[model samples]
Target: MPDSLAAALTGLAFGLSLIVAIGAQNAFVLRTGLRRTHVLPVVAVCALSDAVLILAGVGGLGTLVDRHPAVLTVARVAGAAFLLGYAVVAARRALRPGAVLTAEDGDAAPARVWPVVATCLALTWLNPHVYLDTVVLLGSVAGTHGDARWWFGGGAVLGSLIWFTGLGYGARLLRPLFARPGAWRVLDAAIALVMVAIAASLLLGL
Candidate 1:
């Protein structure tokens, strides 16, 4: 393979490895996609945000972010708070029957667009893990590619786009399972646990 192609594949693989894990962002995307609510905007926001961060990382902003410990500290605190709050909401949803995640919720009024957009933005931007993954780790990795770093970053960007799009659009396949209100409760419970665990890790600096 050509050097450019090789770099691209490496970047793509690395990016997917970083993002394919189960996390708060993925959980939210999965939930929203299942509900078929604002899927396009949510996926777009996630993809675009990752693309920008990956570019910034390749452009050497990763080094700047590293140099400023204070920034990371603040982000860590804020991210923890947000995750904890989201955890509480998810827990409540899990406990309440026919509350939000009811399988028969199709007849329910659609959520306001602004709130969904806001949540998507907050989930994408407020998490310090995003910065660490996209800006610092990926950036440092791309720097090793020398002249091919930008090509590598481009591939990473593509990976983010593909993943988010597939996740948001492909979630329909699971619609049947989520058709049961119990499944939504289980899912929400899982999300709540994941969020709380992550938040605790962040708070304890683990």
Candidate 2:
């Protein structure tokens, strides 16, 4: 049990170490949470997608992904482009002082939950870095311990569930801060800047 606990703790550290970094998914989640729209579905999509990838990582599929350098490179560049596009939109939103940031404000028109869920899933699943983070990197690190691997896997998935949910839900607490139009601009601009910065880092190979 002590060994299990240690593995779990190590997994948690591994998961957090990889995911805690700034990226498109976190930025999108934060932006959506701040907008007070489709928060639950978004969070579910992110968490569930992580679960699948983590499972793949634990089952040794991550190593396969790691070997395919070409595929991973394509994904990284594509993902970075998507993130940069999002950064542009976020910046535009920041400039528009009266944007409501609701379902109505989006191009979907009908504003279905499925699209939000789909978007989050794609963002989480299609990105190559997630595999590197959870499957290859964390899996390689955790596989050193034979029986403790499960503990590590479980810990990593739980960390993801906890984080995406907290980040999605926790942003709600900032409602009052965003209520003030000035604060809203600040928050949106900050989100935009972070997104662009991450995108740049990815493109620049940093």
Candidate 3:
């Protein structure tokens, strides 16, 4: 492969390796996608935010972030709180026997756009893990590509776009399984646990 192609492939693989994990952000995206609610905006925010972060990392902002530990410290506190709160909500939903996960529940309420977008932003921005992966780790890796760092960043950005798009849209395939209320309850319960675990990890500075 050519240098540029090699760099891009390296970036893509690296990016996917980091992002293809079960985390709060992925949980939110999966849930929202299952619900078919504001998938476009949610995916857009995630992909674009990632692109910005990756670029910032490659641009040497990672060094600046490292120099200022306080920024990440603040993010850690707030992100933990946010995750904890979200977990409580998810737990409540799971506990509610009447709460159906299917989008067609007669009592199912339509979600507004902005609130979902706000949550998406919070999930994307507030988490220090994201910064660590995209800015610090990816940035450091990109530096190794030398002049091809930008291409590497570009590939990472593309990876993010493809992942988010597929995840958000591909959720529809699970619609049949999620058609049952029990499936939704289980998913909510899992999400709640994941959120709590990540939040605790953040608080403990893990």
Clashing pairs in 3: none
Write candidate 3's Cα lDDT for 48-151 as tens digits: 99999999999999999989889999999999999999999999989997765575662267689999999999998999998888999999999999999999
Best lDDT among the predictions, by candidate number: 3
Which prediction has more favorable TM-score, 2 or 3?
Answer: 3
Model 1 ranges off by over 4 Å:
none
lDDT of 2 by residue, 41-122 (tens): 8988888888888878888887888778887777778878877776777777789976634432432343577877776876
TM-score of each: 0.96, 0.87, 0.97
How much lDDT does candidate 3 score?
0.93
- Ordering by lDDT: 3, 1, 2
Displacement of residue 4 (Cα, Å) in model 1 is 1.0
Per-candidate local distance difference test: 0.90, 0.77, 0.93
Clashing pairs in 1: none
| TM-score of candidate 3 to 2 decimals | 0.97
